[model samples]
Target: MSRIDYSVWDHIEVSDDEDATHPNVNTASLFRWRHQARVERTEAFRKKGAELEEALAESKHELTRAHEKAGELAAGSSKARDDIERLKREEREWEEKVAAHRREEKKTPWNADTLCRGGFSKIAVINDVKTESVGEETETFMSFEKRYEKDVKRFAAMRSWDDSEEYLSDNPHLLCAETFNLLMMMCVDLEVLKKRESLEQTAHQAVVMRFISRLAKALKVDPRACFRRFFSKMKAADQRQLDTFADELECFKEEVRSAAKSPAWKAMDEAQRELEKEEERLEVFESLPEEMQRCFDRKDVRMLQEVIGRMEPAEARAHMKRCVKAGFWVPGAKVDGGDDDGGSDKEEDDA
Candidate 1:
């Protein structure tokens, strides 16, 4: 069994309650019966999941062989078209079978022991590309996206379980990101050819990855590792539970898109600095002694002098110093340091 990371429980909304028993029945026996029933249901779901997987595998194998056989038929052969259609039908049937099992299995509560021992974990951003690794200068997110063309193509062309598994096992680092992108691209490619069945399968894989990455981010876990955890939880989810995950994924994706465009997180410069300075000046202006404030407001030089004279010399000087620096008011409306009322009637201090 995989290690149970209770952290996944952080944001979940599931309840665990003891069984309700009739007054005539022993509560302990009722509880035991409920526990056994849950165990049996979980085991059935696990067996069904395994069977669905096996059936899907067999269906895909048949579809592959059908494609090869169809290619050997003449271009205008109705039999070849018929063969292809049959394989496509089988594929859809298998997909539906797995989905139906997933829906049913979801009603049962999670059995930690039944969780897959395998899956993806983290989301990592390669920070500083060394000369030895990338063989180039460091690249931004946009630059890396531009360089991903061939890598995307190679991933999209994956046709078999062995090839895909081997490729992913070897390039586990890129599986969560590049693999997902390539899957979506493959869906588009298939859609262009009017291959809706194949397109659906490809898109499903892409959605699974996208959801896994989102879940990993929420739990602060690695996307690659959490991918399996997601599957484990999902495997036991009924339709309602599955729909909840789908809805949350859609909302989260929309939130990210909206936030990416807004400038709320970016820094500001000149206007912001000026605003801050003005606020600081206002704070200083409010801190002055009441008598000094009246001197500033009335621009009364004689009254200001009277106020200063009443205080300790150093204290009065410090008050005046703050007033001057904040441009609250100058000592006088005058040319000299001591402006008589006769000097200039008005002086404007520039902040």
Candidate 2:
């Protein structure tokens, strides 16, 4: 069996591992001082490395620009050739400096703080809604409705991005998957209502949420934690970026309209209209005069005739009209003083 070599471990600088010190010396203070000095040294080395890396990047950029300029100029142009050669030399020098920096970094002995770097990959909830873990129930539209439906509606109604950013900044807890789902549903509802302006505004907000969600995914962070970053980027975005965003907003609006035109949405709209009609009919029925209501309830032609006879002509006409609209009275039905051969009694009050 081969013996493991421990020579690599000799360079680890454990500050507090000193086995001996003067009796009067403050050992704790000494250890702390050593740790602080080591940290300062490491930070200085890292800063130097960063500066070298930046220089190298700048040099490479200049070299690339020079090469492009050289290509554009005449083949025999002396100025472009001179610039390219100078930039190439500078780039090589910067690269050498960067290489030296890396070698120096490797030479720096590892300390207790740097021996083994620790890394963490975790998603933390920023608000009251905790992130669901494996085996936990994920947030859904129904659950979102139960919690944030009203808040989401208020957010959707906001016409300005500035106001929306402020709102989300204040209520970071709402920057979740559920809130996104609600916003999308709101867009669909607004589209179904034929609210073009509101639909566009809500669709824009939904698309913003989607972009934030995507950005968070790309950065491997919680959407709630990084939503403000998205807003900041948007606020500073160039015209091209803004135009792309606008395009996405239009596409999202189209999607909402498409959803609203689906068979399921058509059926829902029809059902909603029927319910509204029924409610209106009930309201008209309730508002009718007691005599007319009784006549309809009893299905008595004579009673209706007597009631209409007692009432003023205009009042009787109004009541009968409401009853007809409410489905209490059928059009063309025979009544007292009217022809019995399937004729309407609508003109009976004239007599």
Candidate 3:
């Protein structure tokens, strides 16, 4: 009636019950499904290929960066190696220079003998001069007694009588035997005079006169002449004290003589010889070369010796001008032109 769409069902197949014993399946339909499956597989393969391509590009970039970093590290390593080599060379050079300096130092000898030519004690001559100034007044006898007491106490404290025996055995002057003997004799005479009342005045005068005579003799003067001169200076009250002082003076003179002959004298002589030798050696060494001579111009004696040992004599002589300028040595050891005889030869040739 209204043109129902029965024509739309034209391709639709209806199978009768009697004829549907086996259902028909088309090969084309199977081929169409297989084609779709194949298309899906191809699309998946394309996606995987695209992903692999992107990953490969990123890997290539990373590899390029790694190579750049490796090159930079290699360059730094090379620079470090170069610096190490340079430092090693500098170290080697420094060591060589130090060794050379040490070798130079070894050639020279240290001479300390120069300092000892004279005894270390300074000797000065003191002239007696009159002074208006007066010191605090003290009795001469009291002062002498105090000094003698102090000397005795010091000697006792030192136990010099016992401990100094070894030194005395080696050197008789160290014991001051002559002074001790003089002191003992004077003491015995005084004791005897004190006990004899009847002969006291005569014995006192005789003892005093004899003591004064002995002192003058020890001093290398005439006893009678010296006593007359000495008595002229004294007031009557001081005469007795002066006589006593004369006795002490005699003993003191002997002590001084004995001390002078001690073993200290021998040691001093040895020291003087050593000093002379040192001065001689240094003077000879200084005469060597001009440059070496210049080194001696300085006050550093040890360094001059070292430099001298290393230098040639001719070279050192050439540098003598510097030594002359510095005043370490006198100049003109080397002459200009030739020897003194050469002048005469030159004059004969000119004539």
Predicted model with the maximum lDDT: 2
For model 2, how does the per-residue alpha-carbon lDDT over 56-163 read when each residue is reduced to its tens digit?
654565567567667878898999888888878888888888898887777777778887776754566677867767435443556667787888878877777688
TM-score of each: 0.29, 0.48, 0.17
Model 1, total clashes: 16
Computed on alpha carbons, the lDDT of every model, listed in order, comes to 0.59, 0.74, 0.43
lDDT measured at residue 300 in model 3 versus the true structure, 0 to 100: 44
Candidate 1 local lDDT, 1-351, one digit each (tens): 878876544542223653455779898987667668877877787767765665565456556756665676677788878867887897899899989888775554445444444555656689986653342322443354466655655644555434544554555565556556556445544544568666544555466666657666645567765455556556666564376455544443444344434465123234455777899888987888888788768876778767766877667667766776776654444534644543212222211
Tens-place lDDT digits, model 3, residues 1-351: 686665433432222443233347565675566557655765675444433433333334334434444465766576555545554565455555555545643432322222235675677688885553334222433354444544422332332223333332343232222323333333333443443342233233333344445445444454543444333333344653455444444444344344435567446546756887777657755655555545545544445546644655555444444444444444223234433333222222333
Candidate order (TM-score): 2, 1, 3
Q: Which candidate, 1 or 2, would have the higher TM-score against the true structure? A: 2
Model 2 weakest 10-residue run by lDDT: 341-350
Which model scores highest in TM-score? 2
RMSD of each: 22.4, 11.8, 54.3
Candidate 2's TM-score reads 0.48
Candidate 3: misplaced stretches above 4 Å?
1-237, 269-351
